[model samples]
Target: MEVLGRDVVQEWECSRNVVPSAFDSHFHLDRSGRVLQVYSLERLIGHAEGPVPEVLVQVSDGVAVFCDPATYPEVYPCAPGFGSAVGLHPKKPHASVEGAVRLVEEELRKEGVVALGEIGLDWTTPEQEWPLQESMFVGLLELACPRRPVILHLRGQDRYSSEVSALSLRLMRENTSPTQRVHLHCFGGNLDQVLGWSTAFPRCYFNIAGSVAQFDEIQRAAVRRIPLNRLLVETDSPNRRVQRKWHNTQAYVGEVARKVAQIRQTTLDEILQASLENGRLLYNL
Candidate 1:
């Protein structure tokens, strides 16, 4: 597809004449799995099927239920459906715990929807509303305990992480199984914090985002303590950071690959190999 006048993403090393079988651990594909609107899932799949690459996609729901109509059915049916998570996003009408539980219950039952979150309390979200966020998270746990894999979005400093940990502990208490694979997407924590969380929960998986490309904390010490098999990469696309583009994209997934390789002192191909395996391991794809 011809990228028009907007800040078109120039093709990078990730899309270069790379070999097939390499996987991008995390990416926010349009529900339809199209890129630049010009490149449809049909196109991407076509390229991926070629000898150069075979990408496993993890389609996400930002804040709204974009899957109401399965914006990704075109590609969903054609590939391994990696499913999506849901919650009362920051911009949406905040649902109370009861209401959020009801929504999560419905989301978990959807055909390709395999998980129950992208949910957490953000400190900057509003003080008075925190109770509701906490309740919703608790409710999500109630509704999704059977479906243990969850995507997390935590904002703020240590307080946020601590609160999140506390909430998680509460959920863990009620969990029937000890295998909740919780993914902290674009978590803003230092290495010590990441290690702490890793040591805290056996199922905790720290997701590396674009900021890892340059941030010393994320790129260095923190990534070291975590086992590569337990690590995953993501591009919380459309969500910007202080480190780079305010929003993220699939292209950034490449940067994620790069950063992971750099941190592990390995090659990008090695990063791809492990990331792909981790995706299957964590998401059960």
Candidate 2:
């Protein structure tokens, strides 16, 4: 609920409380339910249990909050975060696509609104919903300004099927401009497929999340193949907890950076610095 501005962040640092410049590229600040009551970002990051992470200074520092159009009214007055991406969830499409598009347009006009997304296909849902999801995904992509990057959420029926990724890439290729920047959020696919995506969409980048700690060999290999400059890290906080007993927060991006470093046979600081620079570039912060 708290958003720190540049001056406030500087003040905290001046007091000897160092705030790492790491970014949690994707997360939700507007979610509700028991998770909020029992767990918090502060506790997860080793700070006192509280509403927000103590060391997690500013969302604007390196975070990109996603605004779900389906819950726009409730999550509106979007938190004072660094940047935001607005889109309709494929699983929970808006009651009216036209209305949702209008809302997205409005959000894009706001300050710190950097991308159009968390919008893509989810094949795990019933087959009956595929058409609607595709339509909405295409609609949102068309609505996005060529200059704005797009965050994508692509999931297959299960970890085994690559169809969803293939189809999503095809749709993006056909619907979006070649110059548009695309981020494949929480990427879980294999190396070959991702290399294909990189070749097909040279402007696209891939994000690594805390759940990456649980990645199998294939997924780890894919992470290794990602060009460092094209790699970004996130917590997907209040979600994608690395463990059931732990609360996920932006602070945990360090853990993801560590994992990436290990996979790429590099140092943690190297990956951290690279990811930080990559995030600032990707969000144009």
Candidate 3:
């Protein structure tokens, strides 16, 4: 794995026109049981039309989180170059919280595991199951915090309102340490949520994915204000569309970087380079 440091940043600074290969901060290797279809390194680079520039096809590396513990055996060995995370997703109701935690603990002992999520709170599920989700989330956070970085998956009843992120913030505050490394996967909250997380966990990183293209005014403002050093980008492949017309493949990660640059009013190289570095440190690559 090629690691970027100060010298590379200086090289990029001197060569402004040079485009960097993107590190997809969060993506899934097992989606809908078509593991081979989604996990290939070749498929990560998309050949598409529209806003994606030709230069972004070279996706050098990424971290693939297999959130479901049941699929870990099939997904882990197949991913050759990518790092991975293993945990129980809040929305996927497991029969026993202890069994789920033990399964994740076994996977964490494996060779390529790097983080412990795509796990957190989601209010979109049945209201009755909220306690079960909280128990699983609290257990996983207790296991991973201050030991490994966590990639969070938080959602509310609707995009316009996010009580779930607030709920997640409280759980994290009570269970974890202040310096835990966190990646808020596909963050859609407003500026206040950003400030809340940053204030609580100084090492937290907010990831911007295809969802960046659809941000409302306040969400866009949050993107604009995210500290350059604290920003990261992801494909979240096989999940959400990068745009209304395009089915998201890792190849269109450039489109995501483009949207962030447009929102932050910075150069594409700057976004790409900064995100690359942030992803590296967050995953300890």
Candidate 4:
């Protein structure tokens, strides 16, 4: 039995929440789900009215706000589903971070946006800009703490450079609160740390992506240790665990979700119901 935040996703990975279904835990898109802002007078009216850019459409889906913007799309524009999170990407420009957040907050005020981001520190990139990253991220947490759920972006897998770990720990400490919904999406850490955090933080959820889908070794020897309820899934797109295509798409969330169910050894139907419930629980849907 896989346990996640007291919930579970069984083996065979169910399909309650799919394209035809009304729920999804997490999803994204780069071009379409983007909140178009009237940034420059130089590129005004025409840019606003033209057919919305089609980024991740697969001819059978409608995109929704998610932790990864790369998963959101233009064409089949998901028919506005519920239980989601949205935010500026870590690698994106400073303007994207600042501007997209402003828009997201505005959307939250309107009940459109759910999470504060895919905002957090990345050890995978240059360290010289750590302070800039820390500063901007704190701003996001501060901004988001009172308003919406936070979709976190944490990278780096153990054994050195404590800087990333330190930064991440600091952010977690500073941003946490009673009401905020925090999700450390696509998480990576040793088994002890994962369990520690999962035990310590009841509100947080983690996404198991990439190699974890097929039992690729993570630093966590007991990767399956996390419960079915605390567990979530994502394609982390453009690249796939089962197979890769030209780009990653949200449609594969189900495929990955199923793998997660199998690891948990629960029924797909149970996984489906529980995953949707988990999403609602995290995002307050």
**Backbone-clash count (model 2):** 2
Clashing residue pairs, backbone N/CA/C < 3 A, model 1: 19-52, 20-52, 20-53, 31-71, 31-72, 238-248, 240-246, 240-247
Taking all chains together, the TM-score of candidate 3 against the true structure is 0.86
- Could you give candidate 2's per-residue lDDT for residues 1-285 as a string of tens digits? 653211233344564344445666886654522345423232222221223333333233454455565444332332333566777667878766677778788877776567888888888898999898888888887786567888888888767248888888888889877777888888888987778788887878888886777888998888889988888877776677554355555545666777778888998768777777877787777
Cα error, residue 93 of model 2, in Å, equals: 0.6
Superposed Cα deviation of residue 71, candidate 1 (Å): 9.2
Whole-model alpha-carbon lDDT for candidate 1: 0.51
Q: How do the residues 122-229 of candidate 1 rate in per-residue lDDT, one tens digit apiece?
A: 667667766776665666667555345666666654533666555555555565255667777665465666666565566777777776766565436767666777
**Candidate 4 vs. true structure, TM-score:** 0.66
What TM-score does each of the candidates earn?
Answer: 0.71, 0.82, 0.86, 0.66
Worst 10 residues of 1 by lDDT: 45-54
Cα-based lDDT for every prediction: 0.51, 0.68, 0.75, 0.50
**Over 4 Å off, model 4:** 1-23, 31-63, 66-80, 95-104, 157-166, 218-222, 238-241
Q: Which candidate has the highest lDDT of all?
A: 3
Residue lDDT tens for model 4, 1-285: 221121112211363234233133444434322333322212211121222212111112221444343443222221334433466566653654566557545544543455677777775667676666777677677566734667777665444224564566566766676445567666655566566556556665666655454454554354467666766655454344344422333434455555665666665556555556666666655
Instruction: List the candidate numbers ranked by TM-score, top first.
Output: 3, 2, 1, 4
Ranking by lDDT: 3, 2, 1, 4
Native-referenced Cα lDDT, model 2 = 0.68
